[model samples]
Target: MKKHLIAITLILLLIAGGVIFYLAQGDKAKLAAGADTGKEPVFTAPRSELIPTINVAEVKVWTAGEKPVAAKGLALARFADGLAHPRSMLVLPNGDILVAETNSPPRPSGGLVDRVMNYLMNKAGAGVPSANRITLLRDADGDGRAEVKTPFLTGLNSPYGMALVDGTLYVANTDALMAFPYKEGETRITAKGRKILNLPANAPNMHWTKSLTAGPTGLLYVGVGSNSNIAEDGLEGEANRAAVLEVNPRTGDYRIYASGLRNPVGLAFEPKSGALWGVVNERDMLGSDLVPDYLTRIEFGGFYGWPWNYWGGYEDRRVQPQRPEVREYTKRPDYALGNHVAPLGLAFADKVKIGGAFANGAFVGLHGSWNRKPAAGYKVVFVPFAANGEVSKAKPVDVLTGFLDADGHARGRPVDVAGDAKGALLVSDDVGGVIWRVTGGK
Candidate 1:
């Protein structure tokens, strides 16, 4: 009886081995067949090569009559001659360009100090300067001529974000958000400035500039960056510094949409997925130690591990003492931009030009880096993404470079990107005080 049982077990084992061999052979045959049929690999992304899909664009180098237009890391346009330190820009429905000039108040100085009070010297000093208000200008034919130029709105502390909603212009000021009735292409702006939300903003801590974007959901999203590179809340201030606030246009109701952003400058929702996204400028003075600049989806109430952790599992010793507690729980960013590259403006390709390679892509205007000893990033990068909103397969291509010299000096810096009525990509440069348009190789 024992011999019979052993014989039966051997037979069963042989049968199992035969079945395993058969399955392996089948898999091999399928793989060979797939190779022959030119099918994509099963494990890899379906679309691996993320090429740009940009429409035909017209490039216009700014020129002040015979003299070339010039400035630095600024967004500017020829709205009107003699515009002072214009740094931000917006387009009205009627073809008017709103230029936000960041003018510093003249400091009271003694005569002896005034003579040595070189305006250039104060600028050379530190501390980010304040950009006060928006100046409206019009050029009917895009012909480098300002038909009208005037103050659309005034008395703003520091206006950074501008959006036109239902014939009303919403301005995101540093300390508060305000809006006024605005007609596109209107030569002058007379305001009955309505208060939208009063935020305790414009602190000297971590994040200062409050960027705003109107999402497809018809709600306004505001991004406020963190106060410090990696420090915990300052003494008595546990303010909502690094958060994205959602505001309703119809009812003026506002609340925190997302949290834990360092300094998000540009915000836009993916047209196809309705997913919120932003171009964030990471913190400075960490010796390239912590988080990289990132372009990621803004999930509600998500903490990006500011000052404590960064990227994926990288410990930031400067932000907190309990590194072990925060290390594993901290979430990493979707895409890791190179260190110290100050990414600023973002614009998703629109319907007019979103047909081909640009269908699911976005453009970023890097304001460039100053803290990086060598100072990198003075270009506009084109990041192409998959249709499902995943960033892994996205490619960061240099849509525009040539701004920095080989020896590490800045030639130009991009401020913002917009798709004009004709489906062309227009980039505004504050440093050169000009608007440059870019077109695909086609």
Candidate 2:
């Protein structure tokens, strides 16, 4: 009788294994939407899955003398290496660079599903402890490498975005926005930062990158993401989430600048039109090609829809207690960046010293995706714009490639991009722990 029971258990285990393997086949993307930018991205109907397609790239750090592939007439070199998970960057007037090396804070109550996702995150090289500090990198000689590496500011929360206005250096930590007095050419900041305002950050901060950009008019713009994907945590958890906030640095007053962005990551102002723009990572689990991440010129009092709708007025049926009235006012994005590309960095090339196509466009650093089959976006791309600061109807050009090898292992993952004092493109790679510099070809 015992032998019969063991035989039954083995049969059941084999059946379950076969079922999982069949589901793992998942859905394959039909189009290379991530390569196409501007208006009119091809969208497909949502195909929900019982288990999300898990195809995360294995993390393999660069061995030595290995680097990414640059575009034609461009070259790539290591700016600074051997750093912790570098997420964002800021270039000072005196030619020094500040890199925020951080990751998500701990969420002890993330529940069972969250714990499972955390295990996957660890496998993807993003499970390291948050450093909670900013480091300074100086390429004073302009040889495309930083020689002086020092801790600029120490002891902070999970910091992401950074900016310098007047004589104050402002940092957007996960829970609050803080500022410190600054002087040119200083290697370290000894003063304690004054909290300008508290941000919407509790545990289970699913989207914790608080991107910061300074407006020309003494205001700071911050990008905050929704707490849960499609409001699974209820509407009460989304007070200031999924919106951009404008804050007056002098007076500490703040208000919602724009609403309904699912996960706005990179923030920038188009140099010609002076319009504020952002790169948002849209919701996932809607198949490999359902929702496209986007780039848009953010407007005051705008709603792009969250749990209620997506991509203009396409309602997501999975969201419960849906509000149909909100669909009437859902604003469409200016451009679609394709599905699951996970665009994390946005920088304008108006003043970049580098010539050719990169001189007058937007450079986006796609951090790559784990949810999509036959993975997309593990490199940096450039999108051209017209003189009027409007995006052209051209496909995105690959500026940096080779982050993934033939077997889909990630050597590095780009998180944020910026321009250095010399107008060269700077990319922060969080996984490989290096900052890459791109310049005109030799």
Once fitted onto the true fold, the runs of candidate 2 whose alpha carbons sit more than 4 angstroms away are 1-24, 32-36, 109-112
Give candidate 2's TM-score: 0.93
Model 1 stretches with alpha carbons more than 4 Å out: 1-83, 103-131, 142-149, 232-235, 249-252, 323-329, 351-359, 392-394, 440-442
Tell me which residue pairs clash in candidate 2.
none
* Tens-digit lDDT string for candidate 1 (252-280): 79888876676777888777778888877
Provide the lowest-lDDT 10-residue window in model 2.
107-116
The candidate that wins on lDDT is: 2
- Return model 1's CA RMSD, one decimal: 21.3
Which one is best on TM-score?
A: 2
Over the stretch 313-417, how does candidate 2's per-residue lDDT look in tens digits? Answer: 999998998889999899999888778889999999964667776777799999998888888889998888887899888878899999999888999998898
The 10-residue segment with the lowest total lDDT in model 1: 48-57
